[model samples]
Target: MAKTNAEKQKLYRENLLKNKSKYDQMRKISRIRDNKRKKVERINNKQSSSYKSHQSFGKTVKRVLQSLPKDIHKCVSVVHHIAQEFNIIPKTTSHHQREQHSLSIELKQLVMNFYSQDDISYHLREAHQLFLIEHDHTDAYLSLGSFSDLRPS
Candidate 1:
Protein backbone atom coordinates (compact mmCIF):
# COMPACT_ATOMS: atom_id res chain seq x y z
CA MET A 1 0.00 0.00 0.00
CA ALA A 2 1.07 3.64 -0.62
CA LYS A 3 2.05 5.83 2.27
CA THR A 4 -0.57 8.17 3.85
CA ASN A 5 -0.81 11.76 2.48
CA ALA A 6 1.13 13.40 5.38
CA GLU A 7 3.91 10.77 5.12
CA LYS A 8 4.13 11.34 1.36
CA GLN A 9 4.55 15.06 1.98
CA LYS A 10 7.48 14.43 4.38
CA LEU A 11 9.17 12.07 1.93
CA TYR A 12 8.84 14.61 -0.86
CA ARG A 13 10.36 17.36 1.30
CA GLU A 14 13.36 15.13 2.12
CA ASN A 15 13.92 14.37 -1.54
CA LEU A 16 13.73 18.06 -2.41
CA LEU A 17 16.39 18.90 0.21
CA LYS A 18 18.70 16.22 -1.19
CA ASN A 19 18.31 17.64 -4.70
CA LYS A 20 18.66 21.24 -3.48
CA SER A 21 22.32 20.65 -2.51
CA LYS A 22 23.14 19.50 -6.03
CA TYR A 23 21.14 22.42 -7.45
CA ASP A 24 23.11 24.87 -5.34
CA GLN A 25 26.41 23.31 -6.47
CA MET A 26 25.39 23.61 -10.12
CA ARG A 27 24.28 27.20 -9.61
CA LYS A 28 27.64 28.11 -8.10
CA ILE A 29 29.51 26.57 -11.04
CA SER A 30 27.25 28.43 -13.52
CA ARG A 31 27.87 31.75 -11.74
CA ILE A 32 31.64 31.24 -11.83
CA ARG A 33 31.58 30.45 -15.54
CA ASP A 34 29.41 33.50 -16.27
CA ASN A 35 31.76 35.75 -14.29
CA LYS A 36 34.80 34.37 -16.12
CA ARG A 37 33.08 34.94 -19.48
CA LYS A 38 32.29 38.52 -18.49
CA LYS A 39 35.86 39.13 -17.41
CA VAL A 40 37.18 37.87 -20.79
CA GLU A 41 34.71 40.08 -22.66
CA ARG A 42 35.72 43.13 -20.66
CA ILE A 43 39.38 42.48 -21.32
CA ASN A 44 38.79 41.98 -25.03
CA ASN A 45 36.75 45.15 -25.27
CA LYS A 46 39.46 47.14 -23.54
CA GLN A 47 42.20 45.76 -25.78
CA SER A 48 40.27 46.40 -28.99
CA SER A 49 39.38 49.93 -27.98
CA SER A 50 42.95 50.71 -27.06
CA TYR A 51 44.26 49.34 -30.34
CA LYS A 52 41.66 51.25 -32.36
CA SER A 53 42.38 54.55 -30.65
CA HIS A 54 46.12 54.10 -31.06
CA GLN A 55 45.75 53.64 -34.82
CA SER A 56 44.20 57.09 -35.45
CA PHE A 57 47.43 59.07 -35.67
CA GLY A 58 49.76 60.30 -38.45
CA LYS A 59 50.74 56.84 -39.72
CA THR A 60 47.09 56.14 -40.46
CA VAL A 61 46.91 59.32 -42.52
CA LYS A 62 50.03 58.41 -44.49
CA ARG A 63 48.74 54.89 -45.15
CA VAL A 64 45.46 56.26 -46.51
CA LEU A 65 47.26 58.69 -48.82
CA GLN A 66 49.57 55.98 -50.09
CA SER A 67 46.70 53.72 -51.19
CA LEU A 68 44.90 56.34 -53.33
CA PRO A 69 45.35 56.39 -57.12
CA LYS A 70 48.57 58.04 -58.33
CA ASP A 71 46.52 60.03 -60.90
CA ILE A 72 44.53 61.73 -58.15
CA HIS A 73 47.56 63.56 -56.78
CA LYS A 74 45.95 66.85 -57.74
CA CYS A 75 42.63 65.91 -56.20
CA VAL A 76 44.36 64.67 -53.09
CA SER A 77 46.27 67.93 -52.90
CA VAL A 78 43.01 69.87 -53.17
CA VAL A 79 41.40 67.68 -50.53
CA HIS A 80 44.40 68.24 -48.32
CA HIS A 81 43.99 71.99 -48.75
CA ILE A 82 40.33 71.77 -47.86
CA ALA A 83 41.11 69.63 -44.88
CA GLN A 84 43.69 72.13 -43.77
CA GLU A 85 41.27 75.01 -44.18
CA PHE A 86 38.55 73.32 -42.13
CA ASN A 87 40.88 71.64 -39.61
CA ILE A 88 39.22 68.33 -40.50
CA ILE A 89 41.08 65.16 -41.40
CA PRO A 90 39.57 63.32 -44.37
CA LYS A 91 39.65 59.56 -43.88
CA THR A 92 37.89 58.13 -46.96
CA THR A 93 39.20 58.94 -50.44
CA SER A 94 39.72 55.27 -51.31
CA HIS A 95 36.08 54.60 -52.19
CA HIS A 96 35.85 57.46 -54.70
CA GLN A 97 39.26 56.70 -56.18
CA ARG A 98 38.48 53.00 -56.39
CA GLU A 99 35.16 53.67 -58.14
CA GLN A 100 36.85 55.80 -60.81
CA HIS A 101 39.68 53.33 -61.29
CA SER A 102 37.27 50.40 -61.74
CA LEU A 103 35.22 52.04 -64.53
CA SER A 104 35.97 50.34 -67.86
CA ILE A 105 37.58 52.36 -70.64
CA GLU A 106 34.51 51.68 -72.80
CA LEU A 107 32.21 52.96 -70.07
CA LYS A 108 34.29 56.12 -69.70
CA GLN A 109 34.25 56.73 -73.46
CA LEU A 110 30.52 56.09 -73.49
CA VAL A 111 29.96 58.63 -70.75
CA MET A 112 32.00 61.18 -72.68
CA ASN A 113 30.13 60.40 -75.90
CA PHE A 114 26.72 60.87 -74.29
CA TYR A 115 27.51 64.23 -72.70
CA SER A 116 26.16 67.40 -74.30
CA GLN A 117 28.11 70.68 -74.04
CA ASP A 118 26.13 71.69 -70.97
CA ASP A 119 26.62 68.27 -69.51
CA ILE A 120 30.37 68.55 -70.19
CA SER A 121 30.50 71.58 -67.93
CA TYR A 122 28.56 69.73 -65.24
CA HIS A 123 30.69 66.63 -65.68
CA LEU A 124 33.93 68.60 -65.55
CA ARG A 125 32.82 70.27 -62.36
CA GLU A 126 32.64 66.90 -60.66
CA ALA A 127 35.49 65.31 -62.59
CA HIS A 128 37.91 68.09 -61.70
CA GLN A 129 37.15 67.37 -58.09
CA LEU A 130 38.86 64.00 -58.71
CA PHE A 131 41.95 65.57 -60.34
CA LEU A 132 40.97 65.28 -64.04
CA ILE A 133 42.06 68.26 -66.10
CA GLU A 134 40.40 69.84 -69.17
CA HIS A 135 42.40 71.33 -72.06
CA ASP A 136 41.44 73.05 -75.33
CA HIS A 137 41.93 71.31 -78.67
CA THR A 138 44.15 74.01 -80.22
CA ASP A 139 47.86 73.22 -80.54
CA ALA A 140 50.07 75.61 -78.56
CA TYR A 141 51.99 78.09 -80.76
CA LEU A 142 55.54 78.27 -79.46
CA SER A 143 59.02 79.36 -80.51
CA LEU A 144 61.39 76.66 -81.80
CA GLY A 145 64.31 78.24 -79.97
CA SER A 146 66.73 75.82 -78.28
CA PHE A 147 65.33 74.30 -75.08
CA SER A 148 62.10 76.33 -75.46
CA ASP A 149 58.99 74.45 -74.17
CA LEU A 150 60.69 71.05 -74.26
CA ARG A 151 57.34 69.22 -74.52
CA PRO A 152 56.83 67.34 -77.82
CA SER A 153 54.56 68.96 -80.37
Candidate 2:
Protein backbone atom coordinates (compact mmCIF):
# COMPACT_ATOMS: atom_id res chain seq x y z
CA MET A 1 0.00 0.00 0.00
CA ALA A 2 1.31 3.55 -0.81
CA LYS A 3 1.90 5.99 2.10
CA THR A 4 -0.22 9.17 2.47
CA ASN A 5 1.29 12.67 1.93
CA ALA A 6 0.94 13.59 5.64
CA GLU A 7 2.83 10.41 6.77
CA LYS A 8 5.69 11.07 4.29
CA GLN A 9 6.08 14.67 5.63
CA LYS A 10 6.31 13.38 9.24
CA LEU A 11 9.06 10.92 8.38
CA TYR A 12 11.05 13.61 6.57
CA ARG A 13 10.85 15.90 9.67
CA GLU A 14 12.17 13.13 11.96
CA ASN A 15 15.15 12.44 9.65
CA LEU A 16 15.98 16.17 9.50
CA LEU A 17 16.05 16.44 13.32
CA LYS A 18 18.35 13.42 13.58
CA ASN A 19 20.83 14.90 11.06
CA LYS A 20 20.83 18.24 12.94
CA SER A 21 21.70 16.50 16.25
CA LYS A 22 24.56 14.60 14.57
CA TYR A 23 26.00 17.86 13.17
CA ASP A 24 25.84 19.49 16.61
CA GLN A 25 27.72 16.57 18.18
CA MET A 26 30.45 16.73 15.51
CA ARG A 27 30.93 20.47 16.07
CA LYS A 28 31.25 19.99 19.87
CA ILE A 29 33.85 17.25 19.39
CA SER A 30 35.94 19.43 17.08
CA ARG A 31 35.94 22.31 19.61
CA ILE A 32 37.09 20.00 22.42
CA ARG A 33 39.95 18.65 20.25
CA ASP A 34 41.13 22.16 19.42
CA ASN A 35 41.20 23.16 23.11
CA LYS A 36 43.22 20.06 24.04
CA ARG A 37 45.78 20.72 21.30
CA LYS A 38 46.31 24.27 22.53
CA LYS A 39 46.87 23.11 26.12
CA VAL A 40 49.48 20.54 25.02
CA GLU A 41 51.36 23.15 22.96
CA ARG A 42 51.55 25.52 25.93
CA ILE A 43 52.91 22.81 28.20
CA ASN A 44 55.59 21.86 25.67
CA ASN A 45 56.75 25.46 25.38
CA LYS A 46 57.07 25.80 29.15
CA GLN A 47 59.16 22.64 29.42
CA SER A 48 61.67 23.62 26.70
CA SER A 49 65.11 24.46 28.17
CA SER A 50 66.00 27.02 25.48
CA TYR A 51 63.04 29.15 26.50
CA LYS A 52 64.54 29.60 30.00
CA SER A 53 68.17 30.21 29.06
CA HIS A 54 68.35 33.88 28.13
CA GLN A 55 71.59 35.95 28.53
CA SER A 56 71.57 39.55 29.80
CA PHE A 57 73.38 42.40 28.01
CA GLY A 58 75.93 42.95 30.81
CA LYS A 59 76.92 39.30 30.97
CA THR A 60 77.43 39.18 27.23
CA VAL A 61 79.72 42.23 27.39
CA LYS A 62 81.79 40.67 30.15
CA ARG A 63 82.20 37.48 28.14
CA VAL A 64 83.33 39.40 25.07
CA LEU A 65 85.80 41.47 27.13
CA GLN A 66 87.33 38.34 28.65
CA SER A 67 88.17 36.98 25.18
CA LEU A 68 89.79 40.20 23.89
CA PRO A 69 93.63 40.63 23.66
CA LYS A 70 95.48 42.50 26.41
CA ASP A 71 96.31 45.37 24.06
CA ILE A 72 92.66 46.02 23.31
CA HIS A 73 91.89 45.82 27.02
CA LYS A 74 94.56 48.44 27.76
CA CYS A 75 93.18 50.64 25.01
CA VAL A 76 89.70 50.42 26.45
CA SER A 77 91.10 51.32 29.90
CA VAL A 78 92.85 54.41 28.51
CA VAL A 79 89.74 55.55 26.70
CA HIS A 80 87.71 55.06 29.86
CA HIS A 81 90.14 57.16 31.88
CA ILE A 82 90.13 59.99 29.35
CA ALA A 83 86.34 59.94 29.14
CA GLN A 84 85.95 60.09 32.92
CA GLU A 85 88.41 62.98 33.26
CA PHE A 86 86.67 64.82 30.43
CA ASN A 87 83.38 64.66 32.27
CA ILE A 88 84.74 65.67 35.67
CA ILE A 89 87.11 68.46 34.59
CA PRO A 90 85.75 70.97 32.07
CA LYS A 91 89.18 72.41 31.11
CA THR A 92 91.16 69.16 30.68
CA THR A 93 91.78 69.46 26.95
CA SER A 94 95.50 69.98 27.52
CA HIS A 95 95.74 66.59 29.26
CA HIS A 96 94.48 64.71 26.21
CA GLN A 97 96.82 65.36 23.23
CA ARG A 98 95.39 65.38 19.69
CA GLU A 99 96.37 61.78 18.92
CA GLN A 100 95.20 60.49 22.31
CA HIS A 101 91.87 62.27 21.94
CA SER A 102 91.30 60.82 18.49
CA LEU A 103 92.22 57.33 19.72
CA SER A 104 89.80 57.69 22.64
CA ILE A 105 86.98 58.78 20.35
CA GLU A 106 87.62 55.85 18.02
CA LEU A 107 87.64 53.40 20.93
CA LYS A 108 84.37 54.85 22.23
CA GLN A 109 82.76 54.37 18.81
CA LEU A 110 84.06 50.79 18.54
CA VAL A 111 82.65 49.90 21.98
CA MET A 112 79.30 51.48 21.19
CA ASN A 113 79.01 49.59 17.91
CA PHE A 114 80.12 46.22 19.32
CA TYR A 115 77.86 46.20 22.36
CA SER A 116 74.49 47.60 23.37
CA GLN A 117 74.31 51.18 24.71
CA ASP A 118 73.45 49.98 28.22
CA ASP A 119 76.42 47.60 28.35
CA ILE A 120 78.86 50.29 27.16
CA SER A 121 77.48 52.74 29.72
CA TYR A 122 77.86 50.21 32.49
CA HIS A 123 81.47 49.50 31.53
CA LEU A 124 82.22 53.22 31.33
CA ARG A 125 80.88 53.74 34.84
CA GLU A 126 83.09 50.93 36.12
CA ALA A 127 86.10 52.47 34.39
CA HIS A 128 85.30 55.82 36.03
CA GLN A 129 85.30 54.20 39.45
CA LEU A 130 88.71 52.63 38.81
CA PHE A 131 90.13 55.92 37.55
CA LEU A 132 88.91 57.76 40.63
CA ILE A 133 90.49 55.14 42.89
CA GLU A 134 93.83 55.32 41.06
CA HIS A 135 93.93 59.13 41.23
CA ASP A 136 93.02 59.14 44.99
CA HIS A 137 89.76 61.04 44.35
CA THR A 138 87.95 59.56 47.33
CA ASP A 139 85.19 62.14 47.48
CA ALA A 140 84.29 61.79 43.81
CA TYR A 141 84.39 57.99 44.06
CA LEU A 142 81.99 58.03 47.03
CA SER A 143 79.61 60.35 45.19
CA LEU A 144 79.70 58.11 42.12
CA GLY A 145 78.85 55.09 44.26
CA SER A 146 75.78 56.89 45.59
CA PHE A 147 74.74 57.97 42.10
CA SER A 148 75.07 54.43 40.77
CA ASP A 149 72.66 53.22 43.47
CA LEU A 150 69.86 55.17 41.75
CA ARG A 151 70.27 53.26 38.47
CA PRO A 152 67.97 50.35 37.57
CA SER A 153 69.24 46.80 37.84
Candidate 3:
Protein backbone atom coordinates (compact mmCIF):
# COMPACT_ATOMS: atom_id res chain seq x y z
CA MET A 1 0.00 0.00 0.00
CA ALA A 2 2.88 2.44 0.71
CA LYS A 3 4.53 1.70 -2.68
CA THR A 4 1.23 2.15 -4.51
CA ASN A 5 0.66 5.57 -2.86
CA ALA A 6 4.19 6.74 -3.88
CA GLU A 7 3.59 5.74 -7.53
CA LYS A 8 0.29 7.62 -7.57
CA GLN A 9 2.06 10.80 -6.24
CA LYS A 10 4.72 10.59 -8.99
CA LEU A 11 2.06 10.21 -11.72
CA TYR A 12 0.22 13.28 -10.47
CA ARG A 13 3.42 15.39 -10.53
CA GLU A 14 4.13 14.37 -14.16
CA ASN A 15 0.59 15.28 -15.28
CA LEU A 16 0.92 18.73 -13.61
CA LEU A 17 4.21 19.40 -15.45
CA LYS A 18 2.67 18.48 -18.79
CA ASN A 19 -0.37 20.76 -18.23
CA LYS A 20 1.91 23.71 -17.20
CA SER A 21 3.98 23.40 -20.39
CA LYS A 22 0.86 23.44 -22.58
CA TYR A 23 -0.44 26.51 -20.80
CA ASP A 24 2.86 28.34 -21.30
CA GLN A 25 2.88 27.51 -25.02
CA MET A 26 -0.69 28.77 -25.44
CA ARG A 27 0.14 32.02 -23.63
CA LYS A 28 3.15 32.61 -25.90
CA ILE A 29 1.03 32.09 -29.01
CA SER A 30 -1.62 34.51 -27.74
CA ARG A 31 1.00 37.21 -27.15
CA ILE A 32 2.37 36.74 -30.68
CA ARG A 33 -1.11 37.08 -32.20
CA ASP A 34 -1.80 40.26 -30.20
CA ASN A 35 1.45 41.82 -31.37
CA LYS A 36 0.64 41.02 -35.00
CA ARG A 37 -2.84 42.59 -34.67
CA LYS A 38 -1.39 45.79 -33.19
CA LYS A 39 1.18 46.06 -35.98
CA VAL A 40 -1.53 45.78 -38.65
CA GLU A 41 -3.64 48.44 -36.97
CA ARG A 42 -0.73 50.87 -36.91
CA ILE A 43 -0.02 50.33 -40.60
CA ASN A 44 -3.69 50.88 -41.49
CA ASN A 45 -3.83 54.09 -39.48
CA LYS A 46 -0.82 55.56 -41.30
CA GLN A 47 -2.29 54.70 -44.70
CA SER A 48 -5.60 56.36 -43.85
CA SER A 49 -3.85 59.49 -42.62
CA SER A 50 -1.85 59.75 -45.83
CA TYR A 51 -4.99 59.32 -47.94
CA LYS A 52 -6.81 62.08 -46.07
CA SER A 53 -3.93 64.52 -46.46
CA HIS A 54 -3.76 63.91 -50.20
CA GLN A 55 -7.54 64.31 -50.56
CA SER A 56 -7.44 67.66 -48.78
CA PHE A 57 -4.56 68.84 -50.97
CA GLY A 58 -6.49 67.96 -54.11
CA LYS A 59 -9.52 69.92 -52.88
CA THR A 60 -7.38 72.99 -52.21
CA VAL A 61 -5.90 72.89 -55.71
CA LYS A 62 -9.31 72.54 -57.25
CA ARG A 63 -10.63 75.53 -55.32
CA VAL A 64 -7.70 77.68 -56.35
CA LEU A 65 -8.06 76.76 -59.99
CA GLN A 66 -11.79 77.45 -59.97
CA SER A 67 -11.25 80.94 -58.50
CA LEU A 68 -9.16 82.14 -61.43
CA PRO A 69 -10.49 83.97 -64.52
CA LYS A 70 -11.44 81.94 -67.55
CA ASP A 71 -8.70 83.52 -69.66
CA ILE A 72 -6.05 82.69 -67.06
CA HIS A 73 -7.38 79.17 -66.43
CA LYS A 74 -4.51 77.75 -68.44
CA CYS A 75 -2.12 78.98 -65.72
CA VAL A 76 -3.49 76.44 -63.26
CA SER A 77 -0.64 74.10 -64.08
CA VAL A 78 1.90 76.86 -63.37
CA VAL A 79 0.27 77.64 -60.04
CA HIS A 80 0.36 73.95 -59.08
CA HIS A 81 4.01 73.72 -60.05
CA ILE A 82 4.82 76.81 -57.99
CA ALA A 83 2.96 75.36 -55.00
CA GLN A 84 4.98 72.12 -55.25
CA GLU A 85 8.24 74.08 -55.48
CA PHE A 86 7.30 76.23 -52.50
CA ASN A 87 6.65 73.14 -50.39
CA ILE A 88 10.14 71.78 -51.13
CA ILE A 89 12.01 75.08 -50.75
CA PRO A 90 13.01 76.42 -47.33
CA LYS A 91 11.91 79.99 -46.51
CA THR A 92 15.49 81.18 -45.78
CA THR A 93 17.01 80.09 -49.10
CA SER A 94 17.70 82.23 -52.20
CA HIS A 95 15.67 79.82 -54.35
CA HIS A 96 12.70 80.34 -52.06
CA GLN A 97 13.18 84.11 -52.34
CA ARG A 98 13.12 83.88 -56.13
CA GLU A 99 9.97 81.79 -56.02
CA GLN A 100 8.34 84.29 -53.66
CA HIS A 101 9.29 87.17 -55.96
CA SER A 102 7.79 85.41 -58.95
CA LEU A 103 4.64 84.58 -57.03
CA SER A 104 4.19 88.18 -55.85
CA ILE A 105 4.77 89.55 -59.36
CA GLU A 106 2.26 87.18 -60.84
CA LEU A 107 -0.36 87.96 -58.19
CA LYS A 108 0.14 91.72 -58.52
CA GLN A 109 -0.21 91.56 -62.27
CA LEU A 110 -3.33 89.42 -62.03
CA VAL A 111 -4.96 91.72 -59.47
CA MET A 112 -4.02 94.84 -61.37
CA ASN A 113 -5.74 93.56 -64.47
CA PHE A 114 -9.14 93.40 -62.75
CA TYR A 115 -8.91 95.74 -59.75
CA SER A 116 -7.91 99.30 -58.77
CA GLN A 117 -4.60 100.15 -57.02
CA ASP A 118 -6.37 100.76 -53.71
CA ASP A 119 -8.09 97.41 -53.98
CA ILE A 120 -4.78 95.73 -54.78
CA SER A 121 -3.06 97.29 -51.75
CA TYR A 122 -5.90 96.32 -49.45
CA HIS A 123 -5.85 92.71 -50.67
CA LEU A 124 -2.07 92.49 -50.37
CA ARG A 125 -2.11 93.82 -46.81
CA GLU A 126 -4.86 91.40 -45.85
CA ALA A 127 -2.92 88.55 -47.43
CA HIS A 128 0.22 89.48 -45.47
CA GLN A 129 -1.67 89.59 -42.18
CA LEU A 130 -3.31 86.26 -42.90
CA PHE A 131 0.08 84.71 -43.67
CA LEU A 132 1.55 85.99 -40.40
CA ILE A 133 -1.38 84.60 -38.43
CA GLU A 134 -1.38 81.27 -40.24
CA HIS A 135 2.33 80.76 -39.57
CA ASP A 136 1.94 81.65 -35.84
CA HIS A 137 4.30 84.61 -36.26
CA THR A 138 1.81 87.28 -35.27
CA ASP A 139 3.39 87.56 -31.83
CA ALA A 140 6.80 88.21 -33.32
CA TYR A 141 5.36 90.81 -35.66
CA LEU A 142 3.60 92.49 -32.76
CA SER A 143 6.75 92.42 -30.59
CA LEU A 144 8.54 94.54 -33.19
CA GLY A 145 6.21 97.41 -32.14
CA SER A 146 5.79 98.52 -35.77
CA PHE A 147 2.99 96.18 -36.77
CA SER A 148 0.25 98.56 -35.58
CA ASP A 149 1.53 101.30 -37.85
CA LEU A 150 1.81 98.93 -40.83
CA ARG A 151 -1.47 97.12 -40.32
CA PRO A 152 -4.53 98.37 -42.18
CA SER A 153 -7.53 99.52 -40.14
Question: TM-score: which is higher, 2 or 3?
Answer: 3
Query: Per-residue error at 50 for model 3, in Å?
Result: 6.8
Each candidate's TM vs. the true structure?
Answer: 0.24, 0.21, 0.24
CA deviation > 4 Å runs, candidate 3: 1-28, 37-45, 48-65, 68-73, 87-153
Model 1 Cα shift for residue 100 (angstroms): 24
Instruction: Please list the residue runs of candidate 1 whose C-alpha ends up more than 4 Å from where it truly belongs after superposition.
Output: 1-20, 47-138, 143-153
Cα lDDT tens digits, model 1, 15-51, are 7668988767767898999999999998886753333
Candidate 1, backbone clash total: 0
lDDT of each: 0.54, 0.57, 0.55
What tens digits encode model 3's per-residue C-alpha lDDT throughout 52-94? 5777878987997787657655576566567677885333333
lDDT of 3 at 116: 40
- List per-candidate RMSD values in Å: 18.2, 25.2, 21.3
Candidate 2 per-residue lDDT over residues 1-153, each given as its tens digit: 999999998887677668988767767898999999999999886744443446655577688767655797786766667667778535354655564212244433433343344444654557445434444523322345443443335
Q: What is the lDDT of residue 24 in candidate 1?
A: 79
Q: After the best TM-score superposition of candidate 1, give how far the Cα of residue 99 lies from its true spot, in angstroms.
A: 25
Output the worst ten-in-a-row residue range by lDDT, candidate 2. 100-109
Question: Which candidate achieves the best lDDT against the true structure?
Answer: 2
Error of 3 at 32 (Å): 3.3
